[model samples]
Target: MLVMLTGAFGNLGMATAEALVRAGHDVRALDLDTKISRARAAELQRTAARAGINLDVRFGDIRDATYVRHAVLACDAVIHHAAILPPTTEHSPELARAINVGGTECVLRALEELRTPGRLIFPSSVSVHGPRLHERPPVTAATPTRGTDEYTRGKIACEEMIRASRVPWVITRVGVSPDPGASSVTLDTLRMLFRISPKNRIEYVHRDDVARAMAAAVTCDQALGKTLMLGGGKGCRITHYDLIQTLFDALGLGRVPFDAFGDESYYTDWMDTDEAQRLLNFQSGRFEDYQAELAARMRPIRLGLRPGRRALRWGFLSLVRPR
Candidate 1:
């Protein structure tokens, strides 16, 4: 299969592209033209070259219908992973909507208008099931959606559009999947983290795991027109406090007080991923694996900043003001 993947240079995008290539499928990757993206694209090319993977990478924005249509040409499947996530969504709602919702509409229209035979694998977030902290343990595909913010609203809209269209599609409502091997953490991400209560139940998945699932669904007949939940199984399920503690431990910062956490309940919970796991077999990664990767990545930095560890721990308190 020749798969067309949008946002083909982000952490997840690059991972998914590699997974597709490793699976012996040709990849047509599309993403924005930026210095960082260019660098990443070069890296991806090198990786593919070593593995002898067929890769065609193009740089373009998804908001343009013509470009999206042209990008989708001659592809066996489309794995749409492009979106503006939260904190960014909160800061710039219109831009998020334009890219997350409007851009998705462009792709959907292109796929429908062109009468593409292959399926679409869209990566939606579990946050669409709003304020699930007080609800049950595992939310399923049939769970009602209640959008609490711009990002969730956009995801909900895109999912609705895909279902209504005549296109063959798979809507994967993914749990919290962060790249444990990330070089650096963003301030916006930290701010968003600060807004979620530490007590909230979180079913986190690894980026590689999600990418593998997305890659598997590209060719899996069982995934067509199905709404599946992707999570990291038992080992990945934990409280937000546990997650933050692991992260802080990896980064050389001791856990902070519960008072530092947000007052309100957030939309995080363990996802019932039995159907997805049964279909895609993508729940092999565990949180311990993520912690080890993160710790190894930050080892040098942690060593260099060992003297300021106390101050650094206090510095995180700066993310929250008197509230």
Candidate 2:
């Protein structure tokens, strides 16, 4: 199978590309950087050479009509991972709309013109479900999409565009996971409140699981036109308290005061990924296990930043001595 992956050089995009090749599929990776994409393509080619797998990476933005048309027309299926997501989108609303909405429109339009039976897997976000204190667990595909953030709004709008397409498409509304790291208000506020919050349950999935689900959805005809609320299906759910405690423990930060105002709205609502499991053969492990691996990966950086952290702690102590 020939798979076209958008946002190819990104964290998730690269993971997906590598996974697809390892699964024995030829991949064409698309990214915005001409030079970087070419370099990445060479790297992938070299990596594949060592592993007996082959991948082609190209440079292109989904916003360009001509590029979208030319690129999507060549692949057997398309994984639309390209989008202007958070932190950045929160800063540049116009760029967010242009890329998230306009770029998506271009890709869907191309799919319409090509009139090919290509499978499209769009990576939507859980952010579409607006922040609410009464947020419930196991939110399903049938749940309403009411976004509170601009990033979430853009994602919902883009998904709407994808749904309007005549081509077969599967929308996976994904939750926060380690590919992006925890930069949410839930994480920050909880850390500030308690050295940990052991009660607030949160939903998340690893980037690897996300990519696997996306790749699996491509050939799974049953997944077409379906919206899947994906998460770390079984061992995926954890409390912010647990996560914070785990982080502190891993970092050996000692005891710290943690507070929780009992505001569920600060975190993402939980969801059952049964549909994702049934359709995409989803496999998600414990978030703690994912975190351990992340910690392991941070070993080199830990050495690099140890002094800075100590200095910051010292500076904080100096500022707090009843000045």
Best by TM-score: 1
lDDT of 1 by residue, 1-323 (tens): 89999999988998899899888888888999999889988888888888888788889899998899888888889999888876789889999999999988988888887755568999998899998767887899998999999989999999999999898999999998877666766876776677778889999898989999999998899889899999898778999888888878887888777878785678889989998999999888888888888899889888988899998888777865224
Worst 10 residues of 1 by lDDT: 314-323
Clashes of each: 0, 9
* Candidate 2 residue lDDT tens string, 148-199: 7778888888888788778888999887675524334443433333422245
Candidate 2 regions exceeding 4 Å error are 34-39, 50-54, 180-200, 260-264, 300-323
TM-score of each: 0.94, 0.85
In candidate 2, what residue range of length 10 has the lowest lDDT sum? 255-264
Give the winner by lDDT.
Answer: 1
Model 1 vs truth, CA RMSD: 1.8
Score each candidate by Cα lDDT.
0.87, 0.72
